[model samples]
Target: MHKIIVTGLTGFVGTNLKKYLSSYEIESLSVRYIPNQKIEINADAIIHLAGKAHDLKKVSRPNDYYEANFELTKQIFDSFLKSKATVFIFMSTVKAVADKVDGILTEDTVPNPKTHYGIAKQQAEEYVLGRKLPEGKRVYILRPCMIHGPENKGNLNLLYQLVAKGLPWPLAAFQNKRSFLSIENLCFLIKNLIENKMVVSGVYNCADDEVLSTNELVQIISLALKRKSRSIAVPKSIISTIAKIGDIIRFPLNSETIQKLTENYEVSNKKIKTALEIEKLPHTAQYGLERTIKSFINK
Candidate 1:
């Protein structure tokens, strides 16, 4: 049996990975520092998912991201180099690449991370990419976009509530295409990468093949909620002026909310597709979104 160690076993993605990887002898590791030498030496693969998530509230400490994301990752990765671990899978984010992409985000894009969260993740990628591993061993830096699936309780839930309550979405004036990764799809890729020996070491972007507009997302959400979509088209100019005021007033449609609603950053899954060399991934993007929405409705 393949021996694997998965950190952050309680996280959204890690929880998905653990249930999916149950066939393997996977150890659930929860640590803020380097793991034990015994586990370090014995594991066939190490999928590191533990890290400080991006703080949207902006109330978090400045260096917290660096300490939790960069320092902790560096500690484990450095120890992995000294151990017999054959594969080190680092869960990075497309945010580490760019704050805003002109088009689809690919593996080749230059990293220009905007937030402390993004910067810290990029620094961690740099730390791993800077090292050389033992022969036959490989490292993968996976930059996944906004991942959503079962048990997810964040901004998506708020959107779901709007759709569920049949509230007219005020941001329908915003038109943007965004890429989202299904936690199922991400786990599928990780399992495939670990199982396939020919899959070499390098950075890869992860997402479902499809890109959908936020309007389209709302429609899917509406379908799951079994309700009519009530997205409205207020004049953008008026909204922009109101948002400028709301920047101070902290209205729901303020600058940050506008960015969240209107920013178009479609991550390309083409590289990962070609890398895996399969005709289709496990789930379509729309299918995944609909599933997640339904999951929320059920909850």
Candidate 2:
């Protein structure tokens, strides 16, 4: 049995990953963000999932990102380099590369992170990649896009609630394609990496096979809920003005939320898929979105 030590074991991705890796012997590590905190690294595989997620509320301190994402990763990775752990999986984000994707986001894209959260993770990625590795040990930095699953309420949930209440989606004029990562697909990729001895160790973009626009997502929610989804083609300029006002008034549909809802952030998963020697992921984008939408109904 492969013994794994998982940080952030209770998080959305971590919890789902643990359930997927139920056959393995898993140990959870709880590390405080205090200075010089100790990390125990005794396992065949070390999956680092804990980090300060991007605060959409914008209330977090700047140092909090460095301490939680960069410093903590440095400490744990230092221990991993010296320990018997054969594989190290770091859960990075595509935002570390770019906040807005012009076309498809690939591994070759130069990183220019605009947020402290992205900058800190980029720092951690640099720390891991800069180090000279031992002959047997492998390191993998996974850059996943927006990940959604059952029971986790993210922006998708907000859309679901709006659709459930029969509210028309007002931003149909915003035409954009965004990539998403399903938790099941993420676990599948991680498991393949852990079990396959020949897969190369490097940064890989993790995302679903298909890209969906927000307008299409509304339709999917409607299909799942058995409702006729209504979408309004509101003018983009008007929406932008409203979002700017929302930024000042702290409305739900602020500039950031608007960008999040309508941005073209498509990520390419070709690198990881090639490494796994697979043509398609286990779950399709529609299948995963439907599953997640249905879960909201039961809640």
Task: Please give, for residues 43-147, the per-residue lDDT of candidate 2 as tens digits.
Answer: 898999999999967899999999999999999998899899999999999989998889899999999999999999999999999999999988999999989
lDDT of 1 at 123: 96
Off by over 4 Å in 1: 33-41
Please list all clashing residue pairs in model 2, or write none if there are none. none
Q: Which candidate number maximizes lDDT?
A: 2
lDDT of 1 by residue, 1-299 (tens): 28998889888888788889989998887777443433344688899999999887889996888888998898888778888888999999999999898977889999999899999999999999998878988899999999988788566876787778778987787789898888889999999999888887999999988888888988889888778888789898888887899898856668777777789988888877788888778899888888788788777
Alpha-carbon TM-score of each model against the true structure: 0.95, 0.96
Candidate 2 deviant stretches above 4 angstroms = none
lDDT of each: 0.85, 0.92
Provide the lDDT at 168 for model 2: 94
Error of 1 at 150 (Å): 1.2
